[model samples]
Target: MKILLDTCVWGGVCKELEVAGHDVVWAGDWPEDPGDEEMLAHAYAEGRILITLDKDFGELAIVRGIQHCGILRLVKFAARQQASVCLHVLTRYGRELQTGAIITAEPGRLRIRRPDEKGQPLTCDIQGQGSRCELRRDGAGTYRLLPFNRGSSARQTASAWGTGMWEGIKGAGSAPGSTAPGGETND
Candidate 1:
């Protein structure tokens, strides 16, 4: 599969995918950071699957109704996991991800949310205090927090999830002329 990878998942993962005969493109290879919209556009244009560690893509995909081949959103996992673990995860489940589904991988758990899935409000007990979150879309086509906390913002949480998902799809390698930092444009 032709895959566009976010920087977080490209550092050491691209190589593995390449070895497996999958063509991979890192953001650094692109001309720019290519925000969620542009990235999805490029992927769709190139007939590639987006392998990102960003949950915002989910919202972007929903709001714009963009029909991407697929999106892999990493959840949470230990940073020290073995590379083989990543290979196993991706090899076993990568095909399922091609259907525009979200695969979330935790330490020992794996959950999947389809494109048609709507997030429900979650309430958890935090040291006897009630913490609630309603994962709904706002008027601006972004996310709105009903009543969350200050410890971690929604965007951060989403990025973290993206990271884990990327980990599960793991492979390694730096694309040529695409290793520059901070989303610099190639052209």
Candidate 2:
């Protein structure tokens, strides 16, 4: 695969991808920053997947409707983990990358955004741990993160997480935290 690593990505990632037999370009190596839009354009023109830590590319692609081969946004990952995670993502979602899907890879989740046949953006979230846990808004307007047991029902897993964990979703607490298990806090 051909990849364009954004300036924010660790330079070591380029070497790792190269060792994995991928054609890699690190934007950090450039003499000057051509800016995000130009970088995105260059990646699109070259048919390379743009790998970045920036969220702006998603807005540019989804809101501005810019054309691109694909985008993989790695969020909150440490520099040492970037290369392995990048390879893992490529091994798993290479097809999506080839077809222009915007994928956000986070701690233990992957949020995939792609346009439907009608050009409407559709999102699919997959937990990197294996199974999926969906965040849904209830009729009462509260958000619940529903975890599922592999062979069982969603209700079964709810009890495993317990009510306190669920209650944490209601509003901001005295301290910043997460409702998801092993998840990162926003602040």
Candidate 3:
């Protein structure tokens, strides 16, 4: 996989991916900031997946229709945990990402938006699961991982992954502040 690491991503986030044989490049390592729009354009032109903490790319890709190869936005706050989550996502969901999937990551769970046969990316709402949860990008380029809530429509897509899966999805035992039982409920 070809990966473009956003400037905000932790340094080591690329190490494990590189070890896994993915060609990874970082915006921070570049001579200067490529800027968000430019970076997205660069990644798309090169057919590289853009991995970052910036949720604005969602707006760029989904809302604005700025095409991209794919994107995976990590939600962990700490640097170590962020890198760990990156490796975990890549290892567990590599293939889905390869063809073009929009993935959002918190500690234990991932929210994915896959592409259709026509190769157009689907919006969260288009998947019949948009109400599940949403990642909101703040002013500083960080996303607030809203936990999944049990709503009238939300139950239709609720996890059948069981107790341990629930814990992992919620980041219950992994991180200190998060107590989400369903991995940052999408409320």
- In candidate 3, which residue ranges exceed 4 Å CA deviation? 117-187
TM-score of the candidate numbered 1? 0.54
lDDT of 1 by residue, 1-187 (tens): 7777775564566777778778888786666575778888888888777766677876677666777867765555443442344565467556655766555444433344456556521111111123333223446533222334435553454334223112100111012223212342111
Worst 10-residue lDDT window, candidate 2: 167-176
Q: What does candidate 2's lDDT look like per residue over 1-187, in tens digits?
A: 9999999999999999999999999999999989989999999999999999999998898889888889999999999999999999898777767889787887765655554322322222345345565444467633345554434544555455435424222121112233344454422
lDDT of 2 at 169: 21
Q: For each candidate, how many residue pairs have backbone atoms clashing (under 3 Å)?
A: 17, 0, 9
Q: Over the full model, what C-alpha lDDT does candidate 3 score relative to the true structure?
A: 0.64
Candidate that scores best on lDDT = 2
Residue 125's lDDT within candidate 2 is: 35
Model 1 segments beyond 4 Å from truth? 77-86, 116-187
**Could you list the CA RMSD of all candidates, in the order they appear?**
15.3, 8.2, 11.2
Write candidate 3's Cα lDDT for 1-187 as tens digits: 8999999998887787788788999888999987889999999999998998999997788778788888899875698777667776777666667767788876434566665422322112211223344333347533333335655334432342213222122231212233344443332
